[model samples]
Target: MKLNKYTWIFVGLIAAVYLGILIWVRLTNPVYLQKNMYQTWENSYVMHPKSDQSFVNTSKNNDHQNPVALSESQGYGMLITVRAAQKGWANQKDFDRFVNYWLAHRDYVGDQRQTETYLMSWRQYYNRHHQWVNDINSATDGDVYIAMALALAAKQWPKDATYYRSLAKNLSDDILSYEYNPQTGALTVGDWVTRDSKYWQLMRTSDVMPDIFMTLAKLTGDSRWRTVNNTMLDRLVDLSRLHHTGLVPDFAWITRDAAKPVKPNAISTKYDGDYSANACRVPMMLATSNNPKARKVLKKMLRFFSHQQYITAGYSLSGKRLVKYQSASFSAPIFFAVSHHRGEGYDNLFDSQKYIFSKPLTHKNYYDATLTVMAALEGLN
Candidate 1:
């Protein structure tokens, strides 16, 4: 039967409308986009097989090399595994292997100058002279995430609940005793605190993980953990307001005076207040809180970055772009923050997801790849 011209036109209109709906769904549904990102994360970073039971380098030149499992990487891996397990993508056995690998390889440096716990060393190099160096110092953020992962694993695997709970408790206690400064309610960078030293007073803004602190607070029933979160949130908001741009510097010095309240000033005369590698995580961290102040800071940051063509690798506190390159690590958190804000006029969300999905993981870019995975996970949450 020959169709009339009107019938053909009507059919064409239906097809075009269908196509447009498909495009709209792809652009607007964050869950669908998150699933694609998760697949990219799993394919590029996660490794299989007992012999290779770790997140190995799959980016570029490092595939043949032994996996350099940094403490933060292990912590993030465990957290990712827990999430996957909760979603039925992984199992208890997989979670145990990842957790036990890091637990067994932890270093115990006895000296006061170095980290004084059985925490996993910060990094493990494949090089001959330095197969694995403790770096003598533990990163506060690494420990925070590791502790959070353990707390999560406890809930995920009830059969091993006692063991995981104890581990998480000890780590959390150590972090409080060693890293938390009662004098200023600030979590320091490492175990290098001295009563009268300026260096001991310095804090890495990225090291302040409010979400992990909130988790610890719930786990331990201790209000101190909540206090730490509150203190950090206050500092972050103050810093954002101080610069008048809603951007935070990577590092700041917290000064306590007898006559004045404790205040965080951007460290050093040379400190450019550039939101670079470390400060990029600020929005990601803050978005974990339901507090109005936290959301306000996150919204301001989202607004600052929303205007850019691409989220540059670095930016000054004044909203000036500092680097010519765009990075997944930087963009992922911004994507997360924008999603958290649930604000209007953010049509670039799909473009941001596209940039993140544009590359396959390679060995050489493990840091960025890990962060990309983390950001994608954050968006999924």
Candidate 2:
């Protein structure tokens, strides 16, 4: 039957709404498992990055440029295993590989860029060093990854009470110099502002301040850190709610106007719409803590990041456009969120989710392994 003009309009509207809901579910669905902690830990650690036994050198011999596998980004994962250990999560072999890799790479020891070689990480943020580093500490995305690993470790095995404290100092010392705008309450990252850097456009995916400060505060007992962190997170929720769109743009621009609160020039990744990298951390943050507000954010995130393809069980190297991300992103965070959400008493994910992650090692595979270990450890619940 031929549709009249009004009928066509009604059908179009319904189709649009239906598509919107489908996308929403795909973006926010949680990857959860109902199992004991030990079982998940075993599954999570079942396949970690294999050591070439050459400290800092996981690359092949044939290449003239022998790139070291260890970097500050690896520290982003220390949270997983530390949480696992605290929960009595043990798969000694997997745990050992995770720790040994850290032990293998010390430049990542504190998460600061020790050399210019790491400008590459800056490249990850958006191809700029000063912007990513942001004048001294100022919350570089690299530092947060390092801080994340250690903070997660604070509650993990061997109980390094000093570990979290030290890492807190390391990350805090540099980032605190940032101009904390009490008005908008944003801890700016880059040297200036632009459409790409309003929120520190250096990254299309990482939220350096919110997760970093919150993690530091949680790991080291600093309320001030949370103040900065929650501001960003709350602001994020507010913006997304206003849009009525579950998707959180990876970047946005924060303006202080002529009032110019300290460093007034900047732009950030909040403009980016792709959910894969930007959305992974939301559920992980939500799952890791018992905070009421965090739970609320997690609920929204659960609705926002439900698209399962981007939230992989592991990285796929089949020449998929996103796979070339070099970040080795995906399933690791889902498992990490699952691991932590299940709490320190569970462990089935280590084995059950093993098949979802990558094996052997591929282009930039170390980071993927690092993320998986963290997710697995955090999945200790």
Every candidate's lDDT: 0.68, 0.43
Q: Pick the candidate with the highest lDDT.
A: 1
TM-scores, each model vs. reference: 0.79, 0.51
Tens digits of per-residue lDDT, candidate 2, 134-175, equal 222223454456556555555453455475557455555434
Across residues 19-89, which tens digit of lDDT does each residue of candidate 1 receive? 77866664566566556555565666666435535643433544644545567777777887787677666
> Candidate 1: deviation at residue 252, Å?
0.7
Please give me the total number of clashing residue pairs in predicted model 2. 69
